[model samples]
Every structure is written in structure tokens, then in C-alpha cells.
Target: MTESTEPVKINKWDGAAAKNAIDDAIREVLTGDLKCKESFALIDGRLFLCALAVGVALYALLWDYLYPFPQSRLVLIICVSSYFVLMGILTLYTTFKEKGIFVVAKEKVGNVTRVWEASSYVKKHDDKYNLVLVLREPSGKTREASINKTFANYIDSNGTIVQNLVASEVTKLYNSLSSEKKEK
Candidate 1:
């Protein structure tokens, strides 16, 4: 008996198709299992309200105490209002900005696959981990996503563990794909 040696079929996706596949995979991981949703509305609402209230209160309470000059009042109002306005603008911008896991780019080098994506968000003041998963096969790609820390929360109120969850999903996908290549 002789063993037959045959070339294994390797599955390859075109650039656009690969991107779509990665996006779909990310969406599945993020939405289906992780239960992650855009928390922009909640974050923006809280920020706007807080900033408005604080600005108004500061202006009202400090108006008469600061100085009697119209110029002084105008300056104070401008200063306070500007801060709130800036905050509102930033919050709105960040909120409306891409609020979900998106596959920004992907490439294949040799036997390795590199995928760049914006996967998570982090607030301005938050000091927590804000890493977006950079999936690389053969682990030599040095690209990174400029993911902003916006608003994202898990439906199960397990927001604190989102990073670990997302990382695990990324790893799972990478491993699955790597195994597929190995099978071929």
C-alpha cells in the first residue's frame, strides 16, 4: 500500500472579504457572546447634564461674589461656559464616533495574518487598560489602532471585565484561524 501525498486546500479570503469576515467575527464576539453595546448615549447624557449643571451653578453662585464689574462677569461667564462647551463638544464627538468593534485593516504576510481594529473605548479620565486588540499571526506586525476611550459597557453590568473578555475573544479567533491553516 502506498500513501498518497496531496496538496491541502488553503482557504484564503480577498482583502475586502477578509475585512468583512473580521468585522463580522468581531461583531459576533462583541455583541453575541460579550453582550457589549455602545454606551455613548448614557455617557454623553451624564456628561452634558453634569457639565451644564456645574457650569450654571458656578456662574450663578459666583457671579456676585467675584466682582461687580460687567467685564469681570462676562469673563467669568465666558470662562465657565467655555469649559462646559468644550466638554460637551468632546463628549458628543466621541459619542458619535465609531462606537463599535470595526475591522479597520488587515493583511497577510507569509503564513501570518495581521488584523487591525478598534475594539474598545476608554474615558478621558479613566486610568484603566484601553488596549484595542491588534491581531497578528506569526506575531511580527507592529501596527496599532488609535482607539479612543469613549462609551462601552456590557449588558450584564460586567463592564470591569470587558478588557479580559475582549482579549480572550481575539485570542480565540486567532487560534481558530491558525488551526485552520494548520489543518490545510
Candidate 2:
């Protein structure tokens, strides 16, 4: 009789080590903050221009209509002014929210670098957004979060969609940060 060879099924995930490796990768890809400042700056600039455009349109209309009813003209100007003010305020709010704030912070080197308060977007188990921060050192760090649903992107630098780095990638990023801290 001839001996027969059987095929064996191999499963890569047999322990926590494999899981940990996957997790670290997710963190790194999800949290890197290389593009927040430039991205938000672009957004704010565009918004200011939009607000200006709206103001100009309103003003031109008011300018044309004002002579007919001076009192009404005053009212229209006030209303348009209010509109621009609101838009300006909203623009500032978004700029601040996305770009984040800065303060004394730590970096990979254990030396405090001027870290910018920024977040990254990441998708995971489902389509979700994760917050990635950029350190003053300007390295990207992933945080556990879900950015507001309204989070919009404009002219992303690094051409990164900045979406979820994934659980696996995030794990790797976390490892990198750990290594960075160790080095310092």
C-alpha cells in the first residue's frame, strides 16, 4: 500500500504575542499626526474666504437697496453684519477644535517638544474615526477616540486620508511611542 500525505491547516494566531503585534501596528497607522496643523490652517483660511465672500454678496445687495429705504438699509446692514460675525465665530471655533492647543509637553526623547494639539482619524472594527495627535516634536500619536461625525478634511498633507489607522496599526504606533520613550 502507498502512504498518503495529508495537508495541514495553519492558523497564525495561537497566542497573545500575535495579537499584541497586530494591535501595535494598528496604533501607529491610526495615530500619526504629521498633517493636522497644515490641514487645519488650510481649512481656516478657506472658511475666512467663504465668510468674506458671503459678506461681500450681502453688502453689494444692501448697497443697491439702501438708498430706497435708509432705515431698512440700516436694518439690512445690521443683519448682514450679524451673519458675518456668526460665520467668523464658527470658523474660529472649527480651527481651534481641529488644530488643537499647545502647552508644555513630552516627546519621544523624554525632552519636551512643542507638541501641537491635533487629532487623527482612524477606522476600526467598523468605520470609525480615531484621534491622532502630533507632538511638539511633531511626531504622530494615536489616542482612543472618535472625532465628531462632522469631521471634514481639506487638502490633506502627506496625502494621507487620515482615516482610522486600524486596531493593529495603532498597536504598532503605541509600540513606537514606547520605544521612543525608552530611548530618552
RMSD of each: 17.3, 16.8
* Candidate 1 lDDT by residue in tens digits, 69-153: 6647776677667767767766665567535445344445566545544455434445232436544445464434333322232
Q: Give the TM-score of candidate 1.
A: 0.28
lDDT of 2: 0.41
Please give, for residues 1-184, the per-residue lDDT of candidate 2 as tens digits. 0133222122322222323332233333333432111224535665776777587667757665765665567666776777777677676765765443211123333353433333444334332334453433445543332233311231123222223334334344445554564587
Residue pairs clashing in model 1 are 122-149
Task: Give the best candidate by lDDT.
Answer: 1
Cα lDDT, all candidates: 0.46, 0.41
Question: Candidate 1: lDDT of 50?
Answer: 65
Per-candidate TM-scores read 0.28, 0.29
